[model samples]
Target: MKLFVYDHCPFCVRARIPFGLKDIPLDLGFQLNDDEETPIRMIGAKMLPILQDDGKYMGESLDIVHYLDALDGLPVFGGAPDPALVEWLEKWNDVINDLVIPRTPDPVYPEFATPEAIAYFTRKKTATFGDFDGLKARTPELIASLELGLEALVPLLPDAEGASINDILLFPVLRSLSVMDGIRYPAAVDAYRHRMAERSGVPLVSALRASC
Candidate 1:
C-alpha cells in the first residue's frame, strides 16, 4: 500500500495517523507545495491523502480511513455508530474542515497572514456557514456536541478501553483550535484532548506543523 500526502494538510494528517497507529506498512509519498501532477494523476483530483492499494486508488480522508478500518477488521464508526452519531460525525468533519482549520492560521507561516490570504480564507469560510466571527464563536458549541456524542460512544468502544473514531475525528480539530487564542472547551473535552495528545499518532501533527 502507498499513501500520497503533503505534511501541512490536516486531512492528510488525520488520515495517516490511523495507519501509523495500526502499524500498517505503507510506502509514503509526500508532495511538496510546488508539486501538482502526482496527485492529479493518481486520484484525478489535486488532493492530498490519496491512498493506493494494489493499484486501487482512493481519495478523501474520511473515505480512506473507512477503507483502511475495514481492511484491518476495525469498526469504522467504533462498533456501529448510530444514525444520529453518524450524522453528527459527518457534520463535525465538515465543521472542522470549513471553519476551524481555516480560522486557525498556521503558526510557522506569516506569509499566510497577508490581507489577500485573509480575504481568500474569508471567502472560503463564508461559503460554508456565513460570518467568520459567528462560525468561530460556534466552535465551543461544536466541541460540546462532540462531547455529547463521545459520551454515547464511550461504552461502545472495544473493551471499554482507549480511543475510538470519536478521538480520531475530534483530536486534530481540538489541536488546531489550541493554536488559536481564546478558544475554550468543556472540562470533559479538555480531558479527552489531554489523552489524545499522548497517543502515538500525536507526533503526526508535528509533521504538519513543520510543513507550515
Candidate 2:
C-alpha cells in the first residue's frame, strides 16, 4: 500500500500512524502543495492522505486509518473515541488552528517546495484562516491561550495502555503545535507526545522547531 500525503498535514500524519504501529510496509508518496490534479485524479477531489491499495484508491484520514487497522494482526485504534477527549478537541481545536495554520507553510517541507506551491498553500489557507502575517503577529497571545488549554488537557490524557480513537485524534493536534517554539508542554503532555511519536514512528517537529 502507498500513502500519498503532504508532509505538514496532521491528517496525513493520522494515516501514517497506523502503518508504523502495525509495522506495515508502506510506500509513502509526497505530493507538492500546488498539485491539485493528482488527488483529483485519484479521489475526485484535492484532499489527501490518499491510500492506494491493490490498484484501488481511498480518501479521508480516519477512513484510511480504519482500513489499515484491519490489514494486519489486531486493530491499533479501536473502541469508541473518549467523549472527554473529543469534547476537549472541540473546545480547543480553533485555538490550535489559529496557531498551526500560519506556521506549517514556513517549514522546509517537500509539499511546499516550490514558490507556486507555497503560494497555492498560502492562498488556500489564508482564505479560510485570514492571514499568516496576522496570525504570526498574534503568536505570543495564541501561545498564552494554548498554554491554558494544555493545562486543561493534562488531566484528560488517557491511560497508556492501548491506542484509542482519542489518542489518534489528540496526537495530531499536539503534533501540529510541535512545529512552533515557546509553547511549554506540561510534563505529562510532553511525555505523551514523545510516546505517541515513538509508537507511531512519526516524529514531532520539536527538533525543527528548535532550529526555527
Provide backbone clash counts, one per model.
0, 0
Backbone clashes counted, model 2: 0
Candidate 2 per-residue lDDT, tens place, 1-212, comes to 89999878989999988877778888999999999999999999999999999999999999999999887658858788878888999998888899888988864677887889988989999999998999889988888998998999999997544577777798888888887878998899999988888888777886544545
**lDDT of each candidate versus the true structure:** 0.59, 0.86
List TM-score per model, in order. Answer: 0.58, 0.94
Candidate topping lDDT: 2
| Candidate 1 per-residue lDDT over residues 115-201, each given as its tens digit | 564465456647865776777677777666655655654443221125466555655555655554443455566566555655524
TM-score, candidate number 2:
0.94
Using TM-score as the measure, the top candidate is 2
Which sections of candidate 1 miss by over 4 Å? 6-10, 26-36, 72-79, 82-101, 104-163, 203-212
